[model samples]
Target: MHLDKTPATRGLPRERPVLLAYLRWILLVTLVAVASACALSWALHHPSFESEIRVLVEPAEPRVGAAVAPDMETERQVAISGVVTAAAAQQVGVSATYLQEHASVTVPAASTVLVIQFDDTSAASAQRYAQAIADAYVDYRKGQAATLSAASMPTAATTPNYPVNGAAGLALGLIVGVGSALLRDRSDDRLRGPRDFVERTELPILATVPVRRRRWRRASLLPVLRDPSSTAGEAYRQVSGKVERAARQRRKLTTVTLFTSPSASDGVAHVAANTAIALAQSGHRVVLVECDVRVPRLAGLFDIPSGPGVARALVGRVPLNQALQASEVENLSLLPAGSPGPLGPGELFTFGAVGRLLSAIPADIDHVVVLTPPVLDAAETAVVAEHAHLLVLVAVIGATTRRDLEGAAAELSGGPSSLFGGVLLKAGRGGRAARRSQPLPAEWDDDMGPTAPEDDGVAEETPGTTAIDRRGRA
Candidate 1:
């Protein structure tokens, strides 16, 4: 069977990748948070302790016994008292009661210099304390020596010495804290922002969808219809509207294919299935076709048994009617590829049976969304794209690299003859998906005329609904 699939247009958003962008911001903040925490610990604890020294200077005068005066004697004594404290405590080490209590000073007989020492939790604090003591003692001895030299009589003095201690623990803690933050920042591997997309490939992001906390399943498909105000619902409606507008210029309904890159999370298939359901709920007759023969997920998504599906029908053993199963939503259907087996559905992609089965579907369906295999792995997606009216390639924001996207786009560009268009998927508020979409070439828009950037910011808005040519894009 020979099926001629025409090119169809669909609006994809090009707005700021708010979610991916936020992720990058969060990553940067995380790095900063870790740094700040370490700084706090260093500031609050005393890692080093220091002590000070006290010096007493007395002058001696020779007693004069001379010429006949029996005895003349004089004596002098001086006493000094003070306490030692760490110098520039805030700059090098934190102050603590324990460090101050343990500091002591020792003075020896006829010693001009008094030695003081301190114990600090950290080595750096200890070093700093030692340096401060040395500087202070040097100054103290100079003043004492000068005074004693000028005195002609001998004197005795007693002084209470204060001990100095160094800050050691505080310095070590600071280093450890900063180092830990740096290491954590280095090891982080989560997707950061849109810049990551270009790092891997040069492909343009066509559309970006935000992240949703809710699980996506075909059974409960009322959110898009019930709550148009919610972000998820709005996204669903917005995507559906964009698809409709893109196809408005074409005579036949568009066949949009969704495919993740090889490394994409399992979220891509979920996006495609739910997106199709949302379109069907909004009055379009949508059929979700399972094109991922290698790792089929449609049956599991809908909770259906994989029997007489695309694989069976393609081989001509089952009719399309038996293989297609109606979903919970009205006017929506699922064409599963069936369960995993040795039949090698991936092999069936090259055979002509797959084409005939797809073509056999009725033309009344408003849209057909296919969850194809990863572009980098299976040829089935490219094979399926051959018979599709338009290829809507799905890409997760940060997961798919720019190089991979570029390669995918290049692979799809078998010329205008090959039905292909780009659709960026899994783009959330802040993530790799949040960047503005790359501009389409002039030729891609020549036939469609001016289309507006959809509310999401990718597809340009056409002046009026009638502005669409309804014959497919040029």
Candidate 2:
């Protein structure tokens, strides 16, 4: 089961659920922005009335063959001058600056027409201001007939214009939200769905353990031991069944399975503990080995003392039987990682201590489950993986990265260990339902095999209990 081909050829398809997760954050940000914009617009907004006045302008004497237009720019400037503005202000009982700020004058291109626009808080005030400006401009042009003349009295409009549009604001918010969601999806590197693991590694997933929400204050860590009928317990049982079937197919006198991950905190230790329990529940003499000397968790998990375990046995300070401790579970034994000697964890494994420790296990044990440190973080995992009969990779659903899994796979595939498959842990509800319901293998019976004879040889009466051939088929 060693794959020499690179995993780089495998590519993960983008999942809709991951995109929806990204969209949720994007929409949240968009809503906040839109609300703030709307609030500021309301707080700073001032409603005003607008009025327009149209005036017809013409030269006092019509020039039939004029080289250029009758200087409309000069007439436009004269309409908004201080003299006309002062007169408008006096008529309207307002300051000259106020009249100038509120009114504007424009002349239409290639035409003898001037338009005056004014804005005020009151509709009547806006109309009055526009009319006053037009009248003042007409009187000022009375003496300058050669330049321009007011052809008609100004006519003011009563309607007002509003500037805000709700539809436009909504459109802007949606555009921003979608843009942000795309950016977030591009930047996220963690695996978000089962497809990520399947496509990236091209490895068959053995089981998907659902995310266990901490419902109570003191929840037990071993779900299979505490509640075998729970979702988590069922998942562990499924994994254990697969491991047992694989081991049976190997047909080796001793079956050693190593569980490790790309990094720490991926819950490989927990999976190893529960899988051992599940195996022992089915009437197998299972031995759970804690080889992660640097940071051991099985000792604390089972509430057992940590001394005289793997570390002591490896260094020849303690015999194998002295290190083997009994757990509360029936037919299951525990070997916790003892205190790191003066050589430290790194130096202890270099002397071929791990292999010797594993080989020294009692011949009567059915399965030896070893929980090792993360492959990427610790060197001991590579050493242990070399001796184990099978390797099971553990990856957290949302926490593990594609690069990490690929790197771990490449490292193990290059080594001597045979990769069984992978287990995706902490998978949410979707993963649980996505898993195909598989019936337990018929060979996994309560009386799978007879006890080994006293001479450390497999009993001859139980040929059916012997390991199945390497194909894993009965």
Candidate 3:
């Protein structure tokens, strides 16, 4: 997965896996903060009030005749008074006011309304006491009234109201929830969408290859190739479309080279081959050229015999026609770097045959794709890049570093403008691309003739005379 650090023709945004993981963490923290704030507020703002109950009494004195004084009012020693103490208060039909002793009461001097409050275990008991205070004033007033020829009567008992504190709890919870969500979204850094690409680099993205999930193996080829509806197939097709678009723009037989930065992997080869197949499938004659002279890949990918390939072809030791073999896929062909050979001077750079081979391809063929070496080893890739009409760099999502991209960019940057298109590969999860519904293109009968059986794996060769693989893997 090691990729060239240079800014790709289409620099991709940061990985999404990192972003999603961050989002989850943010939400969890937010919820926790909200719950804690609510719990704390409820504990502090819990309501407390006093209430009481009491029997009310209305006492009025019967007024003696107004003239009782003239009639020599009999000196009667009839006196009545009531003492209400903590113990005798309730017995005398009065609610105990012990709780009120610890309570506070406030009232404006100019107002008759009073506010009596106390903390008590029982709301009913507090209400009873509140009632008693109201009753006592009523009784005393009634006696005075009667003596003055005007009497008042006691009123029915009423209980005080209780306060609620639920609203405060809700408010605290909301504040914590929203605040946390916002902070989380801002601090996150992993790239999530295409927008990140614009912000990070100057390269124009040629294609954004969706990440495919299906297990990639040699055996999975047909299933993937046949299932255009599948994510992997679709991605291949899209990549192919990109190739075709780039190819059409070029007026002559074009060499579309695929190279990844740093180490080599099958990713580039897969892209190169698939893209070639896709173009051929679309009815344009295509050739998948194995230009990696270091460690050729065409033999393995096409199941052809491996030997001196582009290197041999360059030296004129192997003829162009002898190096190429028809593919099982129609309108598609393979030019594998023929049987393995030793690296030598003038093998790639000094060859006039290289130019001749380019001239040798029939005009009927639409495109010639070269899978080049890693940019770090620019000798070979640069050679191929020089020859290619358009250069396409395939970079893995995370495996490529900024430094690597920069290096690759420096190597391939000055080439023909617009001839280069960067392909960002493996950017998403597997399932998102795997469940596509389109049927795989039907395998051609004559074109998809028997493919070469698998054999020794030397790896994809480099573009020039260098002895390294395209990925620098060797």
Q: lDDT of each model, Cα atoms only?
A: 0.49, 0.69, 0.49
Please give each candidate's TM-score.
Answer: 0.54, 0.73, 0.51
Model 1, 1-474: lDDT tens digits are 112332322232333433343455445555555555555545665444343333333333337744331111111111111212333233335453433444445555445434445555544445455444444433443543222111111121111111111123334444554555556445534333334443333333334455532443343233464455655566556656666765664545444444445443434565676678678877888888887656566666666666556666655556778879987779898988764334564655653655566566776767877777776667776676665555555655545555556676666656342333344444433322234322222221132122221122111111212111131323
Q: Which is superior by lDDT, 2 or 3?
A: 2
Cα RMSD, model 2: 10.2
- The superposed Cα distance between candidate 3 and the true structure at residue 139, in angstroms, equals 48
Cα miss at 339, model 2 (Å)? 1.1
| lDDT tens digits by residue: candidate 2, 236-296 | 9998998888777667655778999997677777789999999999988999998887777
Candidate 3's C-alpha runs over 4 A off are 1-201, 211-214, 219-224, 253-263, 344-353, 427-429, 433-474
Clash pairs detected, candidate 2: none
Q: Number of clashing residue pairs in every model?
A: 67, 0, 47
1 versus 3: better TM-score goes to: 1
Of the candidates shown, which would achieve the greatest TM-score relative to the real structure? Answer: 2
User: What is the TM-score of candidate 1?
Assistant: 0.54
lDDT of 3 by residue, 1-474 (tens): 112223543443343443353455555555565555555555654434454222222222347544211111110000011322233345335444553353344443433333334344445544554444444433544432111111122232222211122344345445554565556546533223333333343455555555434454453353235565665566667766766765555433443445444335425666677777777888888878766555555666666666445555666665667767887889888877654344442355343444455655666667777776676764666655655555666655444444555566666766542335456554334534221112121221122222332322223222433211221111
